[model samples]
Target: MGKLLLFLSLLPVSGLAGEPVALSEKTYDPSLGVLIIQVNWGRTWKCGQFEHAQLQALTFTQLPLEGANSVVLELQTHSQIAAENTFLPYAYVVQPGEYQLTDFDVAVAKSKKEVIHLKGAKEDMAKAPQSAGTFTIQPGEIVYVGHFGLDCTEEPFLWRFYIEGRSEFESYIAGFRQKFPFVKEVPVQFKLFSTQRFGNPYALENPTVH
Candidate 1:
């Protein structure tokens, strides 16, 4: 059987000038047990005068094996940019027998036919043991995915999405349902850290600007 796909709507890059960016709306079909996330950056939107900007979409999937008590899934995505890309810091935890699914896609207005490709790590988690410490999840508990988006200087936008569920596997589904209830919410704290700039070789070489 093919893997289950979860669709997280294209979350717009907030804090852009006065123009409000509209993100793609997400839908989940409980009957099919499939979740769909899509985001549209719209056309002719300029990130900066000098920057070649475009809209990108990404999807991730998490799943648990039937016989195993633990669940893990390989993470990957397709983007609209070339060279390389980097994602913000994020973390997730599931029940003992639950699993997760994530997918990524990006769309740029520059080319109608070709889309930039966003790459994902082959491993189940984004952070290594040294970076991501051990996480504990209780049985029949559900915790949605936690993501942090940072800019060139590792300044957090303080945006977060949460999922609620009793079983670790069902947390994502629950979180999807909460989108309507938790509308127009922002993070309380913003922290600044230094990290490499995403998708830019120059930023990686010089960590000082991050």
Candidate 2:
């Protein structure tokens, strides 16, 4: 467990496969399954394109498992986005059961600067990363549902997070595994409606991959 957390703490393994793959046919543990909620930086939306700031911090709260409540999950990034794709592994190890993900927040900073939390009523036209959702994991099934894409280039800057479910999501998992070899190969069970937003603007669109 410590080793997995250590691997996730570091950001961007520094390379990507020439072509993305949809990892659909993978095996899972018969007694234990894994859940990965990855936050992508350095690839799309010119994240960290023109600034020294990188996505150094991220956190989520209120993840209720069998007997756990408000279990906080966090990840950190250290690599600067210099025209590269950095995948920060924000994975959580949980028992097979129903879980609710909510109260998500993110922070970006340069070296030695104070981190800022971005979960509030006001901050952008749409608070995509602060989205919430529910999911179920069987005893022998692994799932992938949470994903957030930070776009620093846009006006007012925002997190284009989504509930990915399709080939693209599978491709992301394949890319993630390639970038971080520490991640074990597990079957992906992505749900289309497993992700939704919290707070306002409440009418924002929840994106999904097909």
Scored by lDDT, the top model is 2
Candidate 2 wrongly placed segments (more than 4 Å): 1-29, 41-54, 61-71, 79-85, 89-92, 102-116, 120-131, 151-186, 198-210
**In model 2, how large is the Cα lDDT of residue 178?**
60
The regions of model 1 sitting more than 4 angstroms off are 1-44, 47-114, 123-136, 147-210
The Cα error of candidate 2 at residue 90, in Å, is 5.7
What is candidate 1's lDDT per residue for 1-210, written digit by digit as tens? Answer: 012123333333332222112222332111112112222222223423212333343333233323343334222233333413323222222223223223233333334554443333325333432122122233322222333221212221112222122242243333443443332131111111111322211111221110
* Highest TM-score against the true fold, candidate: 2
**Candidate 2: pairs in clash:** none
Report the C-alpha displacement of residue 24, candidate 1, in angstroms.
24
TM-score of 1: 0.29
What are the Cα lDDT values of the candidates?
Answer: 0.27, 0.42
TM-score on alpha carbons, each prediction: 0.29, 0.47
lDDT of 1: 0.27
